[model samples]
Target: MPHRSELYEDIPSVCWPIVYSPDYNITFMGLEKLHPFDAGKWGKVINFLKEEKLIGDDLIVQAREATDEDLLVVHTRRYLNKLKAGKLAVDRGWAINVGGGFHHCSSDKGGGFCAYADITLAIKFLFERVPGVSKATIIDLDAHQGNGHERDFMDDQKVYIMDVYNRYIYPGDGFAKRAIKRKVELEWGTEDTEYLQKVHTHVEGALNELKPDIIVYNAGTDILDGDPLGGLAISPQGIVKRDEVVFKAARSRRIPILMVTSGGYQKRTARIIADSILNLHNLGLIDKELVASEAENSKVEKMIRDSVTDLTNLSL
Candidate 1:
């Protein structure tokens, strides 16, 4: 018997780094563009795949700014009110600098690395408009803590979040809650193998326990070897390996994943990271083309299986 074609259907990924523009300046001085590194790499990945005829739609845009009611799905009314007025709580450090990540922002104020809400709004938009995708499983793998997401989904059972961040790091609140289904807090020198192991466990649990309809992968690359913010020492290959691991896990479950390049300060690091994730999307296209090639079907299957075996055996 032949193996079943378990890949997700032909779907165009919805991304906002290119279309959505924010007015705030990033913490770094030279990074003075809306959506910064993400949009550029997003274009590169999409363009490369399109030129190769791997993906059809050439649209490289983010959605228009979300409305206040859309944001209310995950944020508190009081917090939103204060953010619009630039008011801050005494304890909360500052408002979210760019878009949503309001987990750290308290009900009465703002804090952590978020400004105007975006993630929650995006989730709401997709849930409402995108047919067959009812709930989302957010996989936030940023080096820094995803404090905002952990906070926002604290009580909501609909959204399942599996955040992997540094323990006792800045905005040290992503793990001290009950909302997250899995929280892997790495120390300063977490090795790649250990990190991948935890990711495998978390993704497996999410699939078995939560059984999400759609997956939104926060493909943050700050965990690279020399990232100023990340303490973990992951090489470029290490980062790529982690991405392949995540994708393979999702593929095995036959899940449709919408990848959001979450965070990565370094440009080169960001490029490589985006390429690895987007490569999977491209690979999906190649596999789709192979569906009609009965004569060459066995060869493609061998290639995919061998590749999978190699990736699964590697450390980190």
Candidate 2:
């Protein structure tokens, strides 16, 4: 049968930073509130894509608000109850901010930064609704580990998680795990070349091992050189190249991906992430936007391969 587009079909390009801040309110994660960081940054990106004529009016910008049931997929009933009670402000593990952040959320509870639903909700939504979409692999490249996702899918064999996080930090729980934890930890003050090498290595591994039907990409921009929360110092060009690498890999493998922007505390986050996503759209990895021409596509292919080789050989 020929492929058909679903929710992402009508909308050639949609940006999701529409959910109100209260939906992600967390008081214990030490980080500030959600603010307009996601939306504001995403808006800049979409506008650029539109100006570049990469997207059309048919694109649907769905505001993803997580329901209680969505949260229940990987969380426990007791923890769910705490969240509903609004008393999650006290416990570090259940605290909304901690779990809300997207980095530290575990299966039943939350950690360092993850508070509520981010990739988990998207994955569940896609899995339950989309046909022939059973298995998934979460590609998380935030400066911090995707501890929440790793723990959530630890025993489920249905989900494969490949994370590239810093070697040391808060909520240190990624190493020495029983599952397929492709944890690539860069030394503090790591540079961009070293970062991309690890991303390429593990991403290649994920393609071979899990053989996922879909990919949930946590396109975090915090790994950039001057990010407020991240430890690495990747150049802006390096970050854009990284996204191209990820998107190309998915496309070559014939995998469909649902991208959810995760981390990136730089003041210029919106611009950076927007550019990266545009690059992804340009490469035809995401169906929401127009694909590049043969010549442009060839350039992207070379850039990704060359950058990956450079990254792999860096001394770090």
Candidate 3:
């Protein structure tokens, strides 16, 4: 028998496919401010969504910290993905874990502030537990190379990885590049026009090549024009458009997608992330299924309650 874990709990139907928690914000006595990456950005994204009235507190799925056993599930193999986010995606058709896209962390090592191989773990979990989910595709659009997962899934033919990152940045793992089925390395200060065009072509091509069961979209905002480490010239609107393109491809193909906010160094990264999600909703790419499912379940629940009330009144 497989070990049961708290990270795999069923969420309420009324909740949106977005998964987050306040604990994901790590503030070590305001050191997060000094740090290049904004550790507290996850909460800021949630706040932005709340201000827009796009999502409610009750409609958000809370994420719990993984225990030792849960960590072991990720460790049993090479590298691991976020198990909770993976489970949520399998059930909801699409899910976004606002805080998890630890692409630089493998099972045994850590780099670029990434401590866990959530992307790899998620893919592995789905293949093991979810039926009809034998294959996975990782569309890693982070600013830096996702060497961690590339190293982990190097030999796995079932997982197809397409990584688009700045070729000049951190962890240029020559060994890891062997895993990327489709690698699109970008130059410093690459802008949106060429970036978006290439993204569309490669995404379309990757899916057409081998349709996978799940799409793990590593949507990193560090590609913003002024990001210090990202070294890309993409605007806020461009980031939003990029997300839309990936989501559209997944939805059109009816492939379940799991998105994770990977790397963004600026303070405004949270706002842009929220804006991208809102754009996705505006495009009708997400949230419809959850709303319809909740309505149907609510009707059934009310009928059960009414029947019980009628029985009690008759007994009286």
Candidate 4:
């Protein structure tokens, strides 16, 4: 039997697949300010969405922290037992986990502020619990290499990874790079035009190479210009367009996708993330109304099929 999890519970039809929680924000007496990454940016992203009337609390799916069992699905037992710390809100079509993108952590190790490998866990949970989800694709567009998941799935052919990051950044792991089937290395200050072109070409190329059961998009805003860590120079509009390209590719192929907000360092990054989400909505990529309409259509089709079956039985 497949594993049952609260994280994969059925949500109300009215709610969007965007996942978030108050606990996602880390606060330890202003100590988070010491780090370059904005720890509170997750909450700020939610606030921006609310202020723009894009989403209300009730209309969004609340994120659940990953339990030990859930973590063990992809992580080692020793890793789960050692720290005991964790934490997706998407249905079959598409979902985005606003808080998770711990691509720097692995089963037995943690780094770059990532304690647990949530990306790996999410994919594993789907494969174990959700039927017909045996293959997965990881599209890591963060400023730094996603060494965590790359290491974990290094030997697993069921998972295909395509990583595009600044080559000069942190965790220059040669072993991890071996896992990336399609690797696009960027130089410092790579701007929107060149950056977006590569993202578009490579994303399409990767999908064409292999159509996976789902696409896991590690959408990091750290590639924004002036980011101290990311080292690239993608513009705000470029980020939004980049998301559109990936989501469009998945939607076109009718593949289920889950996006995670990964590594964004600046305070304005929150607003940009929110804006990108809104752009996706405007493009009809993540609209709640569209999902509801599809559900109603499915219900109607089932009812009609039942009616036809009843008439046939009566004739017999």
- The candidate that wins on TM-score is 4
TM per candidate:
0.64, 0.69, 0.87, 0.90
In model 4, what are the clashing residue pairs, if there are any? 66-87
Model number with the top lDDT: 4
Give candidate 1 regions above 4 Å deviation: 1-58, 72-110, 126-134, 174-176, 285-316
Supply every candidate's count of residue pairs whose N, Cα or C atoms clash at under 3 angstroms.
7, 20, 7, 1
Ranking by lDDT: 4, 3, 2, 1
Off by over 4 Å in 3: 76-91, 288-316
Tell me the tens digit of each residue's lDDT in model 3 across 1-316.
4457555555565678677777677778777688898888989999999999989899887665555455565564343443222222222447777878889877777688776677776776666555556788999999999998898888989999999999998989999999999999999999999999999999999999999877889999999999999999999999999999999998787676778888999999999999999999988888846435433655532332122111100000
lDDT of 1 by residue, 258-290 (tens): 444445656676457445645554655214332
- The weakest ten consecutive residues by lDDT in model 4 span 307-316
lDDT of 4 by residue, 34-61 (tens): 9897888888989999999989999877
